[model samples]
Target: MTIIRRSLGWCAGGLALALAATLGGTSITTAAPPEADPPAMEPTSATSTPGENYVALQFGVFMHYGLATYVKKRPWDYDPHEVSPLTFAPPAEMDTDQWMQAAASSGAKYVIFTAKHHDGFALWPSDYTDYDVASSSAPDRDIVQEVVDSAREFGLKPVLYYSWLDFYKDGGSDDEGNYHFVASPEYVQFAKNQITELLTEYGDIAGLWLDTAPGKFDSGRLQEIKDHIAAVSPTTAFVPNTHLTEKRGGTRLAPADVLVHEAELEGDLPCDATRPHEQSFLAVQPNSAGWGWWSFASRDTTVTTAQDVMVELMRANSIGGAAAVNASPGPDGKLGLGNVNLLAEVGALRTSPTAYVTIDDMVPPCGGTLTYSGQQTDSDWIHTRGTPTGGGKWFFGTRTHSNTVGATATLTFSGPDITVLFEANPGHGIAEISVDGGPPVAVNTYSATRRQSQPLFERHNLGPGPHTLTVEVTGRKDDASANTFVSLEGFRINASANPTIVPVANVE
Candidate 1:
């Protein structure tokens, strides 16, 4: 995930542009696509793998801290000269235990702390860089150590989010004036040294999360990173925020144990067999619109409701990925009352009257046939046990580049509510869908990332009767899309004689 940061002490100029890039969903600039092997595939039911545990952490907490916490502004917006170590200070009442306790109460299995953000401010004392907690006013305090210790105490796995870009180091600025360099061997080695320190010093880190793909490294450098981390922490899972799907350079990514989806989870995209997928998003507070600092005064407005948190978790679970919700601590180093209460509510749901809604594959009526078009063959309608890796059993259409626009699949079933679960990939095209001869709705099935069994279309309250759902390939993609191909996974029908609307408030 792109870090929205600015210098605490510098004038905002290029930093604003950088902040815009992160906010607008764009990377600063990445190196050319690296030549590497495709990500390895893991069975949906694989166990004892390093990533298996990480994947099981369905609900986790993400906290972004560092200079931005004190600056109370976008830390990525400031230049090197704009930042000063003198301005750094540890919270007067530092309570790492409080954070962990809150996480435990919220039923979170893991906690991922921002060990270093884009501002290049290290939460831990690093011998390789003076711009760290050790060189600042809080020289004696190691925020990373405190967090690690507290996580262990609370029985929560501890993970670290490390930024690849550093503005305060020798590579002061890239061509865009961002803190990162276009290509700097000095910074690369610096990263290795700091990572070694973190792996060697920190005891048993569950995962190492790298922010923004290394816009600089090809497979060689990426492989080097994996080797180094494996040497110290062989079991540690490596997850890169590849963002929106394609690898850093638009090619294959250097192999990692897991793949990360920053925010969006499209239905057509399936999880790669080589790596499991994770979904991380902004856990909204009352008034805060984005993922960042929230002052005590802003607490009232930035608070998030417990209902919203539950929905996010449920959605990720439905799609076979973990959800890491972002939450920031106040300057005092403690979570707000509103966040604590929300988490408590979520924890309560664990043992309450929860209805496990089972999603079943739609079986065509005995006489009805699912017609297909294009160069589609009988073999194209392949049955997959768990698509999008870990998704429910379903069938999908598969074929080569036939460019057979207008190819379609039509299904008629007796149901009041229906949902189409489709695959969205970079090459997917637009799909025209209609219900019972209703007006056609064009559903763009294009996605940068791969996800399977994504709930693409749904219609409820159709009244007791049979309906026909027809899906046709438009054989077209938006200018930004990579291809004009389309995929049809399957459908989910809710044909219950009576449907109950259970209010969360009524759940015991």
Candidate 2:
């Protein structure tokens, strides 16, 4: 959740060098070991818990407006304390109603507003600090209250985001520019007091989205904060953005009511249905100037299309998780017209005919449904075995992979089109896919970094009828790949229908 500016150039040189160093200049690849049985998929009940209710609100809009929005500086580029409080200005035309209207039109069920960011500037007149709205140009207004009221008016639940790494007050950095935060007694009490105000003042909030940089705080302090929240608002779910499976070096926040995948930083993975999960991404990429997170001057022209948002939403829903798309307001305190328009389009597409099938529900050609936690039955796939990784890494903690050349997995289904989801990593190989015995398409499933449940192959407009889709292992790989491995996670179709495909199940 640290908003570091990053380039879009996905070069693998750095990862290659790091991997070589880790393995002493030799490539070492390990396939998932075979599992004794597949796990059964669990169904959620009608009367769900708070966490499940949060997940049922499948799409949300994340508002990241704060002091950094006006300054146009990368969030982590400079010490936040150095920024003057006078720089925090929003025009009188600023309207939270407009923001909530855009969110509602986009079919978002909830809104996550950044009540306080890493700069430690509070949106409300907090009793704990003067570095808040009371000291800003808009001293007469309370931004948090406005947002909460507007969200409720628009029939959307409001969720507040609070960063625990407050750079303006409690956190400091070493000479090398690595930020650190210790949960001192005073700091912990200050956080508790502020949180108490938020929970008690804001009536019926849906949840609190807590964020911190890796290695910032100890577990005991986090538990203390959790205990305080539970005591004050037992109904508000505690969501921690710890990036559980990603290589960020911090202890996982234990006993979280919900987990999050910062999809922009970590690859998109399936959600663990046992607990609610959220996958968040920005509505636009970093501007050409490389400013991070919030919207800047140049960001208006670079918004992601509605189609892109629809794809992201579909992927999130297919995996039993919610999607939180961030749309930062500009310095003028208005959302970009482009983002609003695209979101509306996404709303329209949501009502269209789109279907998703997990691997477990897929009926194989050999007349049995695929199961993740039970004995394997006759299937169209050959030379593939169910391999178990961890739940956070793969669907159902298992994926099917084959290393043999000429291995194939065939599916006969009736649909306008289909997209194959799979695991792409340094060890994966190339695959040749064909539809209805049509032309073969080459797909290279290799990445310097491991990505799970990635949509690697997509086919469209195959005419209306039952068609055979085949995936053949070519036993070839990119030069950087370590081995000839091919893995499958799940599949999605453009239209709704029962298909002879595999279901992607949840992990423990």
Candidate 3:
């Protein structure tokens, strides 16, 4: 927000006003810029393997630190002069290691730092520009390096957010200078230079989170950047921050390993991680508005509690992805009270492995259509669908529905030590179960209260490879159906069920 000053007392007299003309122009108006056409999205390649897991580093934090924190500004809001190489300095109390420890304390798996923002200030000592943390006074050190080092100490993967367009530095005060670099070969060279530094200096980096690349740098130039990264850090991943939808539409992204969806769930200070895409997110939930320092005393957002973070994090686990939340710090390099409190509460689940289960390689063979009524009442069923991992009980999907006073579907199977995980969704009512179509043994569908991500584990003993099996979803009392996403990720078969249970292992 630009600060404005007004003069009301009055323009004294003509002569007095003439003398005061240097002070103000009554109503001077600047010429409006031409209406440029809307963003013409350059065609981007879509994922060929759609509907598959595209998430790896799903749950992490986007650290919006640096000068922006010092001035209660957003990453792109601060001026380089405010904390430039000439004027920048760290507080004597600053200890980045402790901050990373605190975040690790909250159970995050990785950290994505804003190494460079739209504001154009470099967090590390960049030869690309002089306006950076190195310009700070006293301890003229590279802030980005410190944070990355700290992340390493905490065992959290470090990803870099390198903004291709700068609002400051190179653009200086040209306003549109940062974005108008479409044809400027200089800007392309500038970007490659910085990327070269990032890849070479930061060894063993997890990935690069590229954002806001100007139109000037086309696919060829972008590919150059990709090659540069690979040549410098072969093991590191390349993840552009298009943050596009999960569905195949509108530039879904080409060679990206991770997808970003930095969005708010409930009570959140909204930010735009959203783009022109269809699927809500490929992975990585958007951080709250409280992500950075705000210059207001207004109630920021309180809806997202620690439990909320946990629920989101667990959901990421279900989808085989991760979550990156935004926790904008105050100007003084400290987490706001709100974030600190929330993380502390979620600390309970930080290291609790039982809280999550990973499901992959589904091999459902006898699976088919599911329905409610008619002569073929959804009464009987047996299905298997999955890709094979090592060997184990895969997550089960209850694709059947009921429409009667009471409807039920049951399955009987003969397999050795195969575990089936049932997660009752919203429509799934209280249910009773039976194993191997044996005597009716009751098990709650467990879809109420503590039902956010309801789950249960069942194991059965069968033979070597193919085994007959069945499952029954019996509706009781009142009829209801949960048309919810039956989370079926984490699949664990007994270690003993290894080679014997792996039916697909020998598939050609």
Candidate 4:
């Protein structure tokens, strides 16, 4: 996300109220009749474009935690050259798990973590530069690794944000003390080395968010880096910050997998039918005194409520776009209480009866039961329990998976609609999903990239009664897949006709 020094008044009140009126305390409304036939399931391909995969993640959190958090300076006035590595003192109580919990509570499917900002301070210990977390006060902590582990444990995809302009290495004032941007050949090689380390060292990165590369890197250089990234991690998306580039009088670079619109309200930017697009904005607006993305000491109250976030989310979904709300952690590496509560409230709103209700594998409603059959002793269904404290209320923190052929897991529940959620990765296989003993639809849950809590099958307008949704392992996989494993996260159901919807005005 870019840091633009502009003030825009928050005017989400009317939109929030309208959204609530449309959804609150109303029976589930569909464009067609309640008895409309469910659509056919489309098969997934292993070679699907990265843009499609990225767009599947409808929401994510943008974390700006780094040296800028300690300085507490506005974006235009901050100078990274004056900040010392010693100032980067994160307490031992700094828990990435807590951060993931908050993100899970926000109903985000992915997390875009700032791996390296404009200050050239890397969260991971890169051999190319000494100005990183390894040289800071927390020398032993690998912040990137911690974030990746925590994000996976909470069933959220991890994406990295890297800045191209480095004040410590290739940026700063000239001999006359005038600000300048430089992209030296040696610096470019150093960046390439660091990027290789990031893509290779990490297990599976969803994408690489390249910031501040508009006027600095030319097409040739960008192409070189893009080709290199493809060689190492083929599935990782190469995304340039188009929002900042276009705003700062730079052309949008080619070969970009996704387009970014910074600080734009929902529906303001047109949806890109050819590629995926995303909008990133601050979760809490700055007060009268300006503050950067990582600075929040001046604001004690939350300006962006859960209703505002929900409206933005629903609008983005309507336009086939994704929303990444920026939330800053304080100098102590802890999220503000207001931000946590705001996220949790949004999660609760999404799972309300009027909204799509998420039912975890172990915790189902309407007397639902999950039964397994055709299990072998050597290769049987394995139930993995999630950490009780890691995932918030939205996540059940439990999953079931198996690689055995002919193994089936069925969910019997009383609901009008249901959607099956699963995990997709290189090791996953094809499965047959059928509703009420209907014709089975084959779904290939194989992807070069890894994503969790993905919707594999969905059905609506089943009336209201006891129904069965079954998934059977087919012992099949794409050519690029490693194995034939199938995993289940949970299911989402619309159970009741009477909906108790909370008004967005009340939340405000």
Candidate 5:
């Protein structure tokens, strides 16, 4: 049997967490619940806007390949003085076709490769920079061209991830240890030169995923970069993963056609309907490999579970959000078999229908009380060692009121299971949870790893009919962590399933 797949993004007001999938050897389309009203967006000249096409593309792959892959050093930890251009080389048999073919098989609509990471290693030879593939050990290899051409062959869009902060050259005006300020006119010109090359040399591109920390550049500077891209590729969607560390009152200076919230906002799209948001996070292999954002050096045990990817995609679509998952390629310039297998599993899950219910406090029929002394922000809630995930709009404890002991979100629902979705970081505190007014149970939600939309707490096999789960902050911190902060994003209730969740297809 084939299930009618409807775009749940347009369905608003009904905040029911719905899950329906065709079972018994049939095809299904995964679906999730609604959380907020779609935002009013700026219309495009084209009938099918770039934002709409992005939303339709439910999943895409974010691949990393750079100096870090060769040296096996974390992107931020590598010492430029010690590195040599001769050291960077992929295996002789490195094949871009393999990557694109796998992406096609995994049901990905696009492939966004790291054209240049913070390490300042360019995949494509750039006329402005000698620190590129042409100058490296693989002098003749054009990884970017290979990836783009291969993606076209496999019927996938090619996008590039460009880092604004360049560690290779120092910005004369503001010279910091690791920070590169685009505020410097010289640096701005340098960026423009490089960007012009990327936009003009490359054929029609899907988009450019720009990554930069907030305060790195002002609104005017950001607009200049956008203007440069517009002059070259008018229709290419411009997505900036900026404003990661900006506070609530601050404006998202460099707002683009789309926003990428990496490991920050998980459950739903934090931005309203005006601008589309792409939900992204690192797919770490093992629970111990740490956050996979900049650790291309550590490839082992960094794979994300296929189950986690499935739920993440469902949650993204539930709130009119697209999903961009990061999976680092090995040092040999090839994806590992384990990562390939996980992608296949996720691809298969996409074919199967998944109906899930999600409840955000901002939405209707999901009324709840949020009591806390800390500030409430709908963005960048998860902070680890001074760096944040750049996507979260939830209530969290502050430094002044570090003790969130009494903060609570009491949710009422009728279901057999309840899963709490929230961000957990090194400074996070434990929560005291109670069901049906029973004795409170202490659940330690603290994780050294910084992540968003985590299903930290779940209760199953309940007695049905109108249940209340009260999650209260204990105002206590783990001895290892520095502060006693607590955070809450949203929740999901596994209520009655009108249509059962059955696997119709298996991904081999």
Candidate 6:
């Protein structure tokens, strides 16, 4: 949930995608196969890691709940009444499992619930403080415990968002010194006491998100806290997201087990899948009209928008990092039921069970494509396109081969001169093509709208041999993946042209 990401960015809603939610009604649909793991997220035609520990998950729920939800005021509002955790607010009867099952059906693979929000209200009983759920009128119920149990029953990864500074707890802050003892013993013990209970009581936490550590990094407290978690469970990821005001990012003072960057990625700050994807992850919640917990002020939150989720999905999948969309549950312990239901209806992904391609083999002489070889698993395959949601072709998420940076691909040429027909720009700027090592030749250099074209016999003469070809893509230079600005359905070889099928070598 709070695992760190590598960039600081602001994104816009250039294109809109809808999110429709479906109530998890009737009875729980007995579990089916795990929502097939999502197709592997691939970097822009490049490298691969052999033993990766993370999954490229597209859907997750972020709940900014706990006692803080009811008290809309800043989490720091200290109400020493030490409100009973459950009494924090009486929400409509909780269908905790109902929501969990809804998430499962709505394609969500994980849930990041707030265990202790920035306010430091523990959702479960903690031996550390009286300011917890146990003190709440609902003291009898362990909401966090129930949420985790329900999440597991449906196979959702339950990542906990824990805060580092407990404005209310003794010694929970970085800058405070006096009143409590510039260095009070209680303050020191409180942090440990709470963190210990979180790790020990929660079963196999998927990850821990640490927020507001202030200058704690320099003091080596970040690592100390991480060590505490490891002592309880070494397999989990200890992600510390410093509200760092620096330019580089919001990673831990030191290289943490994982890095996290929050809401800022507008420069050359690589928030996507090429180059080196930091083990970094990001939490981006796009603003509708403003930055608040209420439905992005009427418009969907960044996570609810298609374009929003798509950008994050691309950035994380390509770079091999986790992408978490920030979603805050309303004071009612719900993601604004209406909003959650909306998110469930819209889907852009073409689940693997139904994806296929059947186009020509003759590329526009711009580049040669390496056809799919094996049945790629969810994380290993996806469809890409040059447009937001238009003509894009399916390709291997892990497919990569070398053909020189500036070079185009083609096979030998021969057989007949029959004109090869395929999709390409015929009415737009110079439609170009290149094969094997030949220079890129223009097909029709003029046109109006974007249109597919039949090959030009004038420049394309064949003598029965094999040749590779590629088309120069059109769009922002930022676009790089094969799906960049083009829908790569297979290509068509001039039926009369000679052809050879060769298996590209060393592409594992």
Which candidate achieves the best TM-score against the true structure? 2
Q: Mark the 10 consecutive residues where model 5 has the least summed lDDT.
A: 498-507
Worst lDDT 10-window in candidate 2: 1-10
Error of 3 at 444 (Å): 11
| RMSD of candidate 2 to true structure, Å | 20.0
Answer with 2 or 4, whichever has the higher TM-score.
2
Report the CA-based lDDT of candidate 3 relative to the real structure.
Answer: 0.46
lDDT tens digits, residue span 1-508, model 6: 1101111111123432222223464331222122222222222222422112323343455555666555545465544234334447545476677657656654556677777865566787665555566556465678788888988998887877777666556566545421122324565456655656665677866667666445434436566666666655555566666536234353436535545555443221233222212222222245432234322222333444433333343334333344555445554455544445434532323132112222122121211223322221222223333222244322211111121222222222322222333233322233345655567655432223333322342334544243434543232122222322222232233331111111121122
- What is candidate 2's lDDT per residue for 1-508, written digit by digit as tens? 1111111111133431111112576444332222211222232243655576786687899988887877687656656545555567888898888888988888889999999887677888776665667666676778899999999999999999987767655533333444454555656667767777787789977788888555665566667666667667766777777774234655466756677888778766442334567879877744442343577652444456665565566555544457888777778788777667766766654543122212332223211123321223323232222443432344323456777777676655544567787788889999888888989999999989887767788887875345667777889999999998888765665423212123433322
- Give the TM-score of each candidate: 0.59, 0.61, 0.56, 0.59, 0.59, 0.55
Better of 2 and 6 by TM-score: 2
RMSD of each: 17.6, 20.0, 15.2, 21.8, 20.7, 17.2
Which regions in candidate 1 have their CA more than 4 angstroms from the true location?
Answer: 1-47, 172-175, 179-181, 213-217, 244-254, 264-274, 289-298, 301-303, 353-508
TM-score of 3: 0.56
Write one digit per residue (lDDT tens) for candidate 1, span 1-508. 1122221333344342122124366543323122231233333333466576686676788876677777766667665456666466766687888888888887888898989877788888766555677656677888899999999999889999887776666553475755234547666667766776676688878788877534544556666667666665766778777553353336546566667766643322232323455667665665543344323322533345555555555444433346677666776777766666666766765433131222233223221235555222423333333234434322322211223566566665543567776667767778889998999888877778765545689898875344677777677787767887666655545423111111111111
Compared with the true structure, what per-residue lDDT tens digits does model 4 show for residues 388-487?
2333221234556888898888776544667777778778999999999999999988978776667778888885446777889999999999999988
**Model 6 root-mean-square deviation:** 17.2
Model 1 residue 82 lDDT? 68
| Least accurate 10 contiguous residues by lDDT in model 6 | 1-10
The list of candidate 2 runs beyond 4 A from truth reads: 1-48, 171-177, 244-246, 249-251, 285-292, 298-300, 354-508
TM-score of 5: 0.59
Per-model lDDT = 0.60, 0.65, 0.46, 0.64, 0.59, 0.44
Query: In model 2, what is the error at residue 390, expressed in angstroms?
Result: 47
Sorted on lDDT, best first, the list reads 2, 4, 1, 5, 3, 6
Off by over 4 Å in 5: 1-45, 172-174, 180-182, 247-249, 264-268, 287-291, 294-303, 354-508
